[model samples]
Target: MKNFIHDDFLLETDHAKELYHDYAKNQPIIDYHSHLSPKELAGNRVFENMTQLWIDGDHYKWRAMRALGIPEKYITGEAPDSEKFNKWAETVPYALRNPLYHWTHLELNRYFGIGDLLTPKTAGKIYEECNAKLGLEDYSARGLIHRMNVEVVCTTDNPLDSLDHHRDLAESGWPVKVLPTFRPDGLITIEGAAFIDYLSSLSKITNIKIIDFETLGQAIKKRVEYFHKNGCRLSDHGLPHAYAMDFTEAEINNILSERLQGGTISKKEVAQYKSAVLGLLGGLYTEKNWTMQLHLGPIRNTNEVILSKVGFNAGVDSIGDFQQAEQLAGLLNGLNNKGHLPKTVLYNSNPNDNELFATMAGNFNGDGIKGKVQFGAAWWFLDQMDGITNQLNALSNMGLLSCSVGMLTDSRSFLSFPRHEYYRRILCNLLGKDIKAGLLPNDMEWIGKIVRDITYNNAKDFFQFPSYVEKAPLENG
Candidate 1:
């Protein structure tokens, strides 16, 4: 067997090895987007056990297990920790070439210095060792942040949240920065019966009398402003595709008025409402200088029976056949022509649309704005080794890879910090191999700087940092 998977592997050039080494060793983590709990970060809490930390909030593993036909007993069921570990161990070898394989190995190595493969043979030892260390004082949430060298993290948050957790973290003067991104998906989706209930929730949060369409608009506006005041500088939207319907404000008001009267909307009316309102939402984001993110091409809620049994996000969403480029172009062109567009990041899942997404991402930038309009990395199902490498190549060929802000885990797992390392390794290998073949120049200093910037510095500078700085070094150090 090979001594090491990444042993002196040079992708760009032989000389590039030194550069990759320097960058990988020193770069801090800047997780600009994720779904980690701000409450846990604020409290700096410790984990009860490795199972709770690894599997409790990870729907990815749950989805993979479902794919392997492992019953829910080993999944979200009431199985013992050892049994769950055994099941996960059984699934590890089958996850070959999956991002989970790399991530699992990287976490084991990074957190526990255990380089051995995890099969049923090694599962018990790995579990016991990790559990023993997790009982120590230095394994708290904040301590883990320090251990991983995470500089900042931005969490997806609802428009209705008071952001008390964020405020508390800010006031605590912790080393790591935890902030929020404004996610208003529930407020914007008007097709469901829950739209009226969402409206009620918004009404309570904004303290506005949302009696009609005009008041509804005002209530959303107020909440966006509230989120802005709470250190939110980005807005996020998840959609099947970009909206293309263009209609007057009065037309939208008419639809809202009908809905207020308890009238059911036609399919056409639903499209019209969603399209117009998404445009309005974009305009609001533009005016506020918020970096707007639109994630497209997901066909959510696929497993009807499982969806009914377990609800959404049990990992049933698949890619949709959406022509995102033309629609995105139309929407962004409208905004850009009006001079009302902010910095925009577009993310999609369909690999076939790579060229389309790359070209369209570059189209919205009229002036020489560095990141005014950009393409986000492979997200969700595409956030794997092959997926991220494909995205990097596409961006490099079509757009500017250096200017492109790189990988974000978008995960709920605390052990997912290794994902950043995984991305860095893949990136270095790609660059190193290219340089080795004399495709790119072997400039170690410049290459190292670019690696570090993409891995850490770019995201740190892009987002706003918290007010507090680091505490003084301990006397012993």
Candidate 2:
């Protein structure tokens, strides 16, 4: 028996399904912030098999395996790919209510037309079939993007990246827009073990002698400018908590000097330095009109023993309970009162802070910029059905859902593109249920357009992709 309802498959009569088919089906994806390698994308690399396609770079699977009681030897270990797939197969049956189960089957169905539910019994068959198709031309990276309707993808990149692949894509003049996002996490964390070494690297990257705080600021500015010239319009940061400390210029400089001279700086000093740098970075974002994203409240790498063995993003990070609202308020209000706040999106990992996240978004959105301060959609661990629905409800209740930019993958696997569709299906279903209950009128045209905009067009416009008009050379008579 094929698991159709178990599939929760969208129906034709369902308003949400109609909306998805009518509006979002043919549109292109504009992934604003992802960790996908631009090099592989430009080269149009192919995957070896389903396991390699889905699990090779995905930390989500690693996390799920850990949750399923799989040993690390099989999770991130050197076990054969077949053994890993078998282990994952055993876990799939137990993952009944999990979004991964749905995502796994959906990818199989959409990509390979395989309708069989994935379980230990059916795993070998599905694996063999999918791996056979892996050799097809349509299975290549760019082909996968084309099949998924992805038009513009901006990969998160460090300050040290030369963006050679980005240049290649631009020169190729493909319809797909592959841009780079300036991620300065390496530069921003001034208390890490490699802080001074990273500073020297930044100096070399920008060819500026970063001897003082001002010099470091200048060096960062230079790199940002370079990134902008190469078609970057977004900046990303990962912070444990939003920095809101007050600091004097002398105070910040003294801390930087201490770190430079091999002196051990205390935790308080780290906070002040981070706060001061974040303020300056916020000011730059304001001046440049760039969209800035903060991934806040991640108690990163909670399993320190595993961290020491396997390193970051190996399924060890967890959400933290931090003073997010007040801290975010201070940082945002500082820029808001000055009329210099840029377009901002806040992503919180802690589900308990959903209201705090939603309300904080409202506080900084006073400039009549529709959807300016957005509470990011279910991110990381929250990218599931319950998570997405809850986030939508929160946004709809506290702010304007119609103005929201629907979903962003924030993912690593090409197979994870189905997540966008999953989000859209859930969104439409919510609206459909409302209409069916007479809460809203079932106007297909308007609702369809809204659906389209949310799933595809909103992200397109939000990220500022080059359009037909923009592509034409400017008149210079």
Runs of candidate 2 with Cα error greater than 4 angstroms are 2-13, 366-368, 466-477
- Total clashing pairs for each candidate: 12, 0
lDDT, candidate 1, 218-268, per-residue tens: 888887766666667788889988876766778788887787667888777
Off by over 4 Å in 1: 1-13, 464-477
Residue 280 in model 2: shift from native, Å?
A: 1.4
Each model's TM-score? Answer: 0.93, 0.93
Local lDDT at 210 for model 2 = 82
Instruction: Name the candidate that leads on TM-score.
Output: 2
What count of clashes does model 1 give? 12
Per-residue accuracy of model 2 over 342-372 as CA lDDT, tens digit each: 8888998888888789988987776656788
Clashing pairs in 2: none
